[model samples]
Target: MYKYDNYDQQMVDARVSEFRDQVARRIAGTLTEDQFKPLRLKNGLYLQLHAYMLRVAIPYGTLSGAQMRLLGDIADKYDRGYGHFTTRQNIQYNWIKLADTPDILADLAKVEMHAIQTSGNCIRNISSDQFAGAAADEIVDPRPYAELLRQWSSFHPEFDYLPRKFKIAVIASETDRAAMKLHDIGIRLRHDDAGAIVADFYVGGGMGRTPMIAPLIGDGIAIDHMVTYTEAALRVYNRHGRRDNKYKARIKILVHEIGADSYRSQVEAEFAHLQTLELEPPAAELARIQAMFVPPAFDTTAPDSVDRSDPDFAVWLDNNVHAHKQPGYALVTISLKPIGGIPGDASADQIRLMADLAQKHSFDELRVTHAQNIVLPHVKKADLYALWQMLEANGLGTPNLDLITDIIACPGLDYCSLANARSIPLAQKISQRFADQGRQQDLGELKLKISGCINACGHHHAGHIGVLGVDRKGVENYQLSLGGSEGADTSLGQITGPGFSEDGIVDAIEKATEVYLVKRENGERFVDTYRRVGMAPFKEAIYG
Candidate 1:
């Protein structure tokens, strides 16, 4: 992880001071809700249906154990003693009081973390693969470039206020773990024929009421010109993107309306102009940033094998453990989605425990995944059994990675003002419906996502079995979809027939999975079966 310099520290300190005053005036009744709306939003504060929610950015989903301890402290001392890890790899604290936010920001600043650009019509947090530097299959670590972009985009004068919120994601591996194509700007980092690092650009991908997979705009932009080309792309979108209606304000809609070819032409034109200005950073600075992300020291113990004597330990080893680049080590995912528990909620004590584990077992670092899980990216394989025991005792050791029980759901009506129905309870009920470990394992690699509304914060649009909540004539209703994916073979799901009530949605999911069980071929995932057979049979089973 990159450490903040004096300049970064000063900027964060200044922002905290500015927001502190603004919050004071709002409480003093000098500024009304409408007046304080943008001010608070710029600072990553939102007035939700029940209380205020504060979103803190975790850049590229990387953080130190020290930073994690600070976050745990904030959660324990401030709001509700628990924090929600979002799909964007950020953390949100609900039940926030306006007066205490400045204090919270002060504490975060002490640890080089902040809520800046976590919300508002700006270039939100830049995300990368959770396993950025640790992935065994990476072509190059994408975090150095991501950190460079973070410095370039933060409070840029030209893009301070875009037409809408913009997102950018970078991935360097063959597998698309970051869902890069589903971002406003997705950069694929790879080596060219000459083995030089290059970035392939994809523009205009997003999900909301209108969803789109960003089209490829440029093919081999040299690493040196990454920032320059990005400037060109954002300049085009900022200049021509829709501003009249919030519904059509995202760059994805602009690309869809103007056509990809025309948009590419405009970006190329802008690139031609930006190149003359020599906008890229100095080579030394880039090298310095890259050096910070170099791989950590590995112990030479190099054990020959892992102990999986216990049945539960073997299951966890199979589900939660991922291959690591270092010998005798593995990347372990601490599943926040314990069966019948909230998907991404980590209690303060659990957070502290993870920090302690990372400090002792790993190399004092951890990563947050876009799937709402935490990764100890460098755990020794020999330690798996002991780690599982600790995590199980803390309620963080559910071995349901990519299974039906590990559902991704948003705060929904429970915390979000824009939600149409409660997503948490629905997710819980559906999780319970498939609670049997053997049954979920039999289903094989199913992804279920739920969103309370069309905002898609829950990312229902990308699930294998997606459920969406809606208000039908003042009554809460849920809609089901199938075959949505957010991986290398990314595709949006198609809606299945009419909507169902809360309980009906859970039952509908059961019926649809049963159809998969009947129709699936050998070695086929639920998504594979759905894609092969299409939606007709599942729709018939659920509706009939």
Candidate 2:
């Protein structure tokens, strides 16, 4: 984990002091709600349906045990007893007092974390593969590059207010675990034919009112020119992106209106201009950042095998464990989505326990995944059982990774004022319907996502089974889509026709799964089956 230097610490401390005064003004009636909206939003504060929600950034989804402990403390002391880990690799507290936000930020500053840029029109938290350094197949760790971009973008005057919010993702592997193509800008680092790392830039990708998989605008870009190329891309978008209509403001919309070829040409022109100005960070700076991310020391003699004698442990090992880059170690995903529970909500005690486990068993580091799970990235294989026992006791050991019950859902109407219908209840109902562990295992690798609206905050556009809640004449209507995937081969789902009532949607999902089971060939997952047979079967099953 990267530790903050004196400058980083000082900047955060300054922001905390500044915001404390701003918050005091708001509470004292010197600033009205309308006047304070943008000010609070820049600090990641939101006035939700029931209360204020504070979103804290976990840059590139990486945090240390101490940071995790602080988050738990914040949840217990400031807001509710639990916090919601979001799809963007951030955490949100649903019940927050306006007066406590500065104090909470002050607490975060102590641990090198903050709420800055988690919201507002500027670039949001830069996301990356949760398994960045730990994944076995990655060419290199992508976090340092993500951090470089983070430093470049934070409070940059030119980009402080764009036509719309911007998002970026970086991934080193081809697996696309962070939904790379579903971001405003996606960077994939790979080794070129010359055995040098290069970045492939995918621009104009996003999900919302209009969903798009970004096209590869530039490939084989030299790693040294990464920031320059990114600045060029953003300059082009910031210049021509729509400001007339908020609905048409995303870079995807601009890219769609103007051809991809034209967009690429514009970015190249901007890149050429930036190259002349020597805008790319010096190589020494990159090396300095990379030094902070060296792999943890491993116990080379650690056991490479697990006993797996206990049936429950065996099941968890199969479902939740991932191969690690280091031998004799594994990446364990602690599922926050227990059956019949909110998908990403973890209690303060659970959070603290996870922090303790990370400190004791892992490398004192934890990662928040885009799937709303936590990763203990460097756990020794020999210690797996003990770790599992501790997590199981804390209600964090649900072995339902990518299963039907391991849902990704948004706060929805339950908390989000912008939501038209409730997503949490629907997610709960669906999970309860598929509570049978055997049934979920048989289904296999189904990424189910639900969103209260078209905002796609829950990434419904990329799920194998997607449920989008809409307002239909003041009643809640659930629209079902099938075959969407956020993988190396990214694709948006197709709607199954007429929307259903809340209960009807759950039954419809069951029917769609039945179709998959019957039509699927050997080794076929739900999305694979849908792609093979097309949406006709699912549409018939769901609509009928």
Candidate 3:
């Protein structure tokens, strides 16, 4: 995990103090709601459906045990008894009071975390592979570059008031776990034939009113020139991105209007100028940032004392865990998407227990996956039994990590001001709809994501079966999308057809799955079968 330097600590501390005064002034009526809106948003505070929601950044989805404990404390003491881990690798408290936000920011500052850039139109939290250093498939760790981008974009003057929020994701492996195509800017870190680290840049990829897969802008860009190249891309967006209609303001729209080739050429022209300015971060500075991210030492000895035969524990070990790079260790995902529970919502106690477990058994490192789950990235294989026992007691041991029951849903009408219908209850309903463990396992690897509106915060566009809620004459209606994926071969789902009533939507999903089961080849997953057969079968099965 990356530790904050003196400059980092000072900036956050100063921001916290400054925001405290701003909050006090707003409360005292010296500033109106309109006056305080941008200021509060800049600090990651948003007025939600019922109350204020505070989104705190967890840089690159990495958290120290102490940091996780602090987050648990914040959830317990401040507003609600739980927090929602989001797809952007950040956490949101949906029931925060306006008065407690500054205090919360101060507490986050204590642990070298803050809400800065978690919101606002500037580059939001720079996300990367949750399994960055520990994943066996990684070509290089992407966190150092993410951190560098974080520092550069923290309060960038030119981009502070962009047309819309900008998101950037970096993936170091050939397989894209961070959903790079879904970000405004996506960087793929790879090495050249000569074995030097370089980046492949994708720009204008986003989801919302107009979803677009980012087009490749540059290939084999030297790692040293990352910041310069990124700035060039941003500069192009800043100059030409829409400013007239808020709906058309994202870079994706610009990419569509201008065409990918022209956009790439424009970015390259800008990059040529930036390259002349000697703007590449110095080698020593890069080394200094890289030093902060060195992996923790692991115990090599595999303890032979523990039994792995416990049926319940073994199921969790097999489904909820992944292989770690180190011998005798594994990466464990604690599924927040327990059957009949809200996806990505963990109570304060569960959060604390996870912190404790991370410290005790996983070298104090934790990660939040893009699938909206928590991960202990390096747990000893031998200690799996004891870890499962602790997790079971804490209500965090759900043996459905990537199954049909493990849904990813947004805070819809229940909390989000922009939502049309409640997503949490819908997710709960869907989970309960297929609550049988045997049934869910039989269904296999079906990702169901729901969003209240077209903002696509839940990434409904990327689900194997994406459910989107809409208001049809003040009545809640749901739309279904098929064949979407957020993994290595990322693609936006195609809509099945007309929207359905809430209950109809669930039935529609079941029908779609049934269609897959009938048409699937041997060993084919839902996505694989859908891709093979296309939407004709699904459309016929559901609508016919």
Candidate 4:
């Protein structure tokens, strides 16, 4: 994991002190809510429905066990005894007090973490594959590049108040685990014909109201030029992106207004100009960042097999454990979406236990996934059973990876002031409705995502079973969509028809799954089945 140097520590500490005073002034009524809004947002504070919310950035989802333990302490002391890990590799404290935010940030500063840039119109957290260094199929660990971007974009004045929030994702896997196509900017670390790792830039990708899979803007860009290339893309968008309409303000909307070709040309022109200015970092800086992400040493003679005679362990092993590049190591995903539990919510004890597990079973490193799960990226095969025992005791051992019950949901009406309906309760109901572990395993790899609004916080547009909560009249209604994916084969789901009531949507999802099971072929997941037959069968099942 990357350690904070004197410069990094100084910057975060300074920001914490600055925000502490700003918060005090706001509380004293010296600054109006309007005046304090942007200031608070820049520091990742939001006045939610019930209380203030603070979003803390976890750079590229990488953290040491010590850092995670500090997060657990923050969750226990500053706010509620739990925190919600988000899809963008960040975490949220929903019950935060405005007065406590400064202290919370100060604690985070100690751990090389902060809430800065988690909100605001500037670049948000830079995300990468959760299995970055350990994945079997990784071309190169994308974290170093992602971390470099984090340093470059953090508080960058030029992009400080853009048209809207911007996000960037870097993925090194062939399978696109980071939902790369759903970000404002997606960088693919892939090899060219010359067999060198180069970056393929995708521009105008986003998933809010107007969902889009960004078109490729530049192919096989030199790794050294990634930062300058990104600058060019943003400059183009910043110059011509719509400011007239808030709804049409994202880079995706701008790319649509002007054709992808025109957008590409504009970006290239900007890139050419940037090159003339020699804006790209020196080779030494990239090497320094890359050195920070070097893999932990693994004993080559360690046993490669685990005892899976225990039925529960077998289930967990099959679902939660992933292949690693090293011979005797596995990537273990700690499921936060337990059956009937709030998706992504982890108790303070669970967080500390995870930290201990990472320190003991895996290396001292852990990662937060885009699906809102914790990952022990380098756990030894021999320790699987022992780790499982610890996890089961802590209620963190849910064998529901990629299954229907492993839902992704936002804190909708429960916490968010902008939400049209409650998402957590709906997600819980659906999870309970499909509580049969056997049934879920049989169904296989069904991603169900719920968003409280069209902002798509839960990435409902990318789910095989997409549920979007809407305000129909004064009552809450839920819309169902079918056949979406946030993978290598990315696609947006289509709405079946009119939405159903909160309870009705859960039943509607059941009906749609029934249709999928009846129509599916061998090795076909719900997504594949839905794609093969289109939305006709799902519409019939829901509406008939």
TM-scores for every candidate against the unseen true structure: 0.99, 0.99, 0.98, 0.99
Model 1: clashing residue pairs? Answer: none
The residue-by-residue lDDT of candidate 3 on 172-280, one tens digit each, is 9988888898889999999899999999998888888677888887888988899999999898999999999989999999988999999989999999998999977
TM-score (C-alpha) between model 3 and the true structure: 0.98
Clashes of 1: 0
Rank by lDDT (best first): 2, 1, 4, 3
- So what's the TM-score on candidate 1? 0.99
- Candidate 1 lDDT over residue span 431-492, tens digit each: 99999999999998999999999999988999999999999999999999999999799999
lDDT of 4 by residue, 280-341 (tens): 78889878888888899898988898888999999999999999899988999999999999
Top-lDDT structure, candidate number: 2
RMSD to the hidden true structure, all candidates: 1.0, 1.0, 1.4, 1.0
Q: In candidate 2, what are the lDDT values of residues 267-371, reduced to their tens digit?
A: 999999999999889999889999999999999999899999999999999999999988899999999999889989999999899999999998899999999
- For candidate 3, what's the RMSD? 1.4
Q: After superposition, how far is residue 288 of candidate 3 from its true place, in Å?
A: 1.3
Worst 10 residues of 1 by lDDT: 299-308
How far residue 338's Cα lies from its native spot in candidate 2, in Å, is 0.4
In model 3, the worst 10-residue window by lDDT is: 300-309
